[model samples]
Target: MSTFIDIHALQTLPPSNINRDDTGAPKTATFGGVPRQRVSSQAWKSSIRQDFSESLDSSQLGLRTKRVAEKVVKQIEQLSEGYDKEKALSEVAAAFKTVGISLAEPKKKKNEEEDSTLESGYLLLLSNQQINRLAQAIVEANGEKLKKADVAKILDTQHSADIALFGRMLADAPDFNVDASCQVAHALGVHESEPEFDYYTAVDDVVKEAEESGAGMIGTVEMMSSTLYRYANINLNGLVKNLDDSEAAVAVAVQFIKSFITAMPTGKQNSFANRTLPEAVVVSLRDDRPVSYVNAFETPVKESAEHGRRYEAAKALAAEAQELSETYGMEPVKSYVLAVGDLKTALEGLGEETNLKVLLESLSTDLSKVLAN
Candidate 1:
């Protein structure tokens, strides 16, 4: 079943560039002298998903299987009234296995030692020999000769040697519910002032930095980058309750997430970033000679042509991405990629003597206020 969710819930206050210089003054920089907070798109995704259920993925028994197994067990118990529960269950499982349903003997947990008495909570525990005897009894009761192949198939698919299970859903497609759940409706703005930098991101080598820091900060722009681009994934399941069906799943999911977003002539674009251009530009700069980074509060750059090139390149990519999206498909993956290109280009061009500090101070502070809380 598909759930209809509003995309607005996904939006958030723009990220802030609230860090200070070594002297404890507010950080400053310029991209046309305007400061911009550099929040990555991913930080937003994680923070929001966090507000929801943590047990969402723990549906261990696969919903459909549990439901069907329940029905199957109840039906068999009545028929095998003369027999014990175990014997009755074995007989019915054989018949279902004879049909085309795919059933399986529940997998045993690796850590559990197999006892002759069987584990207390395991729903299915009949041994190979027991299953055969059960199957034989079932065939005799039905008054039909059962082909071994048919019996195996039915048992493997439908009569999952299982009883107690969880995570069953009434509806088939679970992903549609998740996709339809969230949307970032507002184009929030970022700001230049705050008590602290919402985050400090090291450029280029995120994994190295993560390893060095012991524990990485949560919901940082860099963290967003690391999650989607480097780790985790956004998957699309098919149109229906089809599982392990890649083609169907991809088509259903792609169409789903893409549909929630619409291009508009006049609508606000939300951003979680909040900083002045000079501040961001300063941080973007990678000075490898000393293997150290310049602070937004300490060094300013807007004069160097190299710095200009990097800023311009990043802008161009972002513009290109927007243009491409407007021109063609604004596939989420592609759009985000272009945005990242903008960020990487900007970061690479930072230099020691640039002069964007003034421009950042001058941009509309209202824009900054719009994104950050």
Candidate 2:
């Protein structure tokens, strides 16, 4: 049976545009007949990936870009002494072609010759180990060339932690596709919210008081503030299978939990400085399946005169989760919680209350035992 790890958080952000639409306004979604501020899962996943680099080694991570050929070329040059840029590019192109990924022809610039940088048709996700192995293979080939089966095998296995968690889709090579072991939900506000605009101006610093009487520039930025409910889950079985290492899987899981809890989307952060920690967090280990408490606010939470939205939202979430678990007999095998203010009391029965440090330590220990089996 597959075990699932579900992470839920209730966070509050001040006036900020963490995720925006094409019109440069904060994203919003209508729920329960009311509009609520929204943050895309893509945005949060990116933040989580960025956070991974801080704690994990670069070798355990992957690179997603259209310049896979160029990266391979650089690696090839570094691995061999005699190979120049042109020779390395040729070898990289031939190697990718063997695996059914054709490098696009170099596009010429205006009044200049064609650029030699080779790129794939779309973004490719590759692990550092895979790149190194491929480069070594090319260097070892010594002009004999690599076989399709060999190149395909290298591309299919040895996935990095991020690739194992997020997965990858290769349209040109469907056989090499990797299904993601994790799912992230779009964060939604617990209560109705409306976009608010900030209108301001900047004065020309060089202009004197007599030279300029008015501001030099003026503009408005759309933003919103609200208490948001964020949720995500990871399939431990899938992650372990992708990584092919239980120990590494456990480490990745720990880092993922910490990143998800702390990483914030940095959209317009310089302007608003809206960085804040979650008011409450719940991590649940379930043998049956993952659960999301987002529907708990389907009716939309309301702030009380004494308690704010975060407190009210946490209370509602706890009540809803308890009722669901009891009614459906879906109680988790283990649950841990980190909360502040009145939220501690509100979510006491939800799980074992602890601090972030202790919670992560306990999680790593528990995950090891579970994955060991």
Candidate 3:
């Protein structure tokens, strides 16, 4: 129910600049010989879940929870009037301050307090299998009673598992304990508005003639949509809390959410060459590869598109196809591989075979047929 985190932003974050060298502090590393700032697999996981929870309309968590709890304290303070209830609520509010969890806040207006984050994303820290494991732990903790789990699952939930553990957590923990954890899960089944995001590519309009007038024809092009999804799972029981295991609910949720992110409101992304998109050339071997499109059909490529604009086209198509493969059950991916190959072939054919008239015409038709509106 939210936009995919931007990998560019994720890659550029300054390494944990904090002075502390503690376990929870941010981490840094040198990737490709460049000093890179990194959110630990842990930090990355937590950040995403936090963001996803908000966009999905699940609930505000962390310090926000404390503020809301403070609001409740304020009400209790009024009810307490002259009674010790004021002191008790005050003390509880302080506990909330210590843990940074609360039950209330200066009420946000309707459609207010979105959890959208700018400039960052997960870079394959937690694999899908790992995400599932984390959800399992959280479910065990909730056990029809997050209150009674007695910190067993809390201890069990690791930093690496942060994305699913916290995001789908529907109940806000009120009791204090050794874990020092705060933040509520999205209230069971609250329609967390889905996370929405997009990436697009546009083929350019290119001309071969240095014109007092135009030449034979302009370069052919097309547009496409790209998306990369990291971890996604929904615990329906967590949201519904109908069963002892809240985490299991999200299994269905994860699929449903993944579907929402892709294949809905399909359209072409307008990213174009240089003026709109300075192309990044990339080359990949495609020979003898079995690629499938939406699992409707599949085939292997005759050659790897490389060494030119075709290379770049191949790269883009490859990236999108691989990404879509994760969620759409393979057919979409196959379709992508075919289009990219077809495009690469077309581009490579330029300047040969009579200005590539045949190739260009074939490519234009192929691009049009395979890429649907």
Clashes of each: 61, 0, 39
The 0-to-1 C-alpha lDDT of every candidate, in the order given, reads 0.29, 0.91, 0.28
State in Å the error of residue 346, model 3.
16
**Could you give candidate 3's per-residue lDDT for residues 61-173 as a string of tens digits?**
22222223234334444544543443444444343333333322344469888532111111212223323333333334332322324233432233222233333232343
lDDT (Cα, tens digit) per residue for candidate 2, span 192-259: 99998889999987775568678889999999999999999999999999999888988898899999
| Best candidate according to TM-score | 2
| 2 versus 3: better lDDT goes to | 2
Which tens-of-lDDT digit does each residue in 1-373 have in candidate 1?
1212111101112222222245533333332344532333333333322321232232211222222433444444544555455544454544544543334444557997652221112223222322444444453566454566655443332211111111112132222121211123222122232233334444446756566543344332221110001111221111122233333233322322332221111111233333111122211111111111112212122324544433443343334334543665522311121122334554342222222333222212321232232
> What are the root-mean-square deviations of the candidates from the true structure over C-alphas?
19.7, 1.3, 19.4
The model with the greater lDDT, 1 or 3, is 1
lDDT of 3: 0.28
Candidate number of the best lDDT: 2
The deviation in Å at residue 265 for candidate 1 is 36
Model 3, residue 59: distance off in Å is 5.8
- TM-scores for all predictions: 0.24, 0.97, 0.26
